[model samples]
Target: MGRHREYDVDKVLDATLCVFWRKGYEGTSYADLTEAAGVERPALYSAFGNKEALFRRVLDRYQERFMNHIPEALGMPTAREAARHILFSSVELNTRSPEQAGCLGINGSVAGSDESEPVRQALIDFRAAGETQLRERFVRAKAEGDLPPHANPEALAAFLMAVMHGMAVQAKAGFSREMLEAVAEQALSAVPGGGAAPA
Candidate 1:
């Protein structure tokens, strides 16, 4: 009989996320993954197929671990509160991690082109889903008369998305958590009547 596999699949994928998050998909190699994951190359190939397949798995796992909770954060009592939480959480995510990979969605996707169409599309889809969730929250706020009747939920969502991606880029450039928090505070201040603006 063949030798039994020893490592956990979820653990391996989690490690793979760090490798790809820090290096990007194209930047990471088989040796990089193997070393980071502490798994043999043969085991990795057996479990994840190829490099692209492994990267996709890593993305999916990351989404499950990180992205899925975003909607819950947006479920705060008010739309503005939810937006603040999302922004602050993103800043925290980038700064708190020792890996300093930036936002995987922003760094990996924005850097990719037609040659990396599949990965790029995956990132776009993830962002679109996030925007949709944010828009719905804004729509609920508008219905509650918390926002101006003319406020467009879709536009607000798009603007927030842009701001988020900008933060991700800046974080990758080594901006500190304090700087990111200041940016978030300014963005939050721009929201109409969200209490007193930061001093």
Candidate 2:
């Protein structure tokens, strides 16, 4: 072998994700990433090129590790229950861990700019995909008699996504899990079925 790699790529990506999740894209410096990832600046640059490239790696990893659950959540029995699980799980993901708080994609929004078109588009696509999935779930729920016949599945999905993102932003602002749950409860309560909503 030419040289032995001193750092683990998986571990470094995990740590980098945590750092970005906590400090956000712009807030995290190269030094912060190096230190948090337990690698020197040169190593980080060698591995990832720059902060933007590194964040793309982190975001990609986060999508696979965390956000891929969206499809499964949508596949559940009822849209309302799926909505509840998605929101509550997001709250748990954001607040239950000390290593990172908030979502990487949501945090990415803070640093997103027109110049960062790829990153911004990725986040937008993530949100749109989520909204579409939620809409499908709502459509299925309505067909199954779990929701009112007149409910607009697409609009309801968009609404639930709004609630999810709002809660994620609030969680990033130091909201507690219980508080976020109450937020979820209130949002769910506003649905047509109240607490009896299925999913």
Candidate 3:
């Protein structure tokens, strides 16, 4: 081996993620990353290339870990369960941690300066991938009679994605978990053949 590393890369990435989650990509600074990640400037730069590269890695980590709930919901036995689970779980995920209250991807990319456009687009693409999967899942559900015959799977997918993202926005605005759950319940109840509204 050429050299031994002193830091746990996973811990560093997690810390950096918390920083980016609280402060968007454009708002984060070199000092923020170094202090949060505990890697120092030189070592941080040498290992991760630059802030942009490091953020991309952070995004990957967020997707792999924090976003598992989406996939878990999508894999539910019924489409209605999928919808309800995703919406309710979104509220839990967004509000579970008080300090890191909002979504990392949304928090990072909502406002991007020109210099951070690439980071913004990357986040957009990541979000779109989840939406695409949701659409496909809904289409299959419709075909399997889980959704009403007249319901449009594409529109349903878009609607759910909108609600999900809106939960993120609401969470960032300091909405309580119960309040967000009510929103999610209303969303799921409104879905065509989605089941009875939560009581």
Best candidate, lDDT: 3
- Using TM-score as the measure, the top candidate is 3
Runs with alpha carbons beyond 4 Å of true place in candidate 2 = 112-114, 193-199
Query: Model-by-model lDDT, in order?
Result: 0.80, 0.79, 0.86
lDDT of 1 by residue, 1-199 (tens): 4878899998899888888888777677789999989999999989899887887888888788877548776767766777788888888877777575478877667445565787778778878988988888888788887766888888888988888899988888889899999999898886654532222
Q: How accurate is candidate 3 locally (lDDT)?
A: 0.86
| TM-score against native, each model | 0.89, 0.87, 0.93
For candidate 1, the 10 contiguous residues with the lowest summed lDDT are: 190-199
| Stronger candidate by lDDT (1 vs 2) | 1
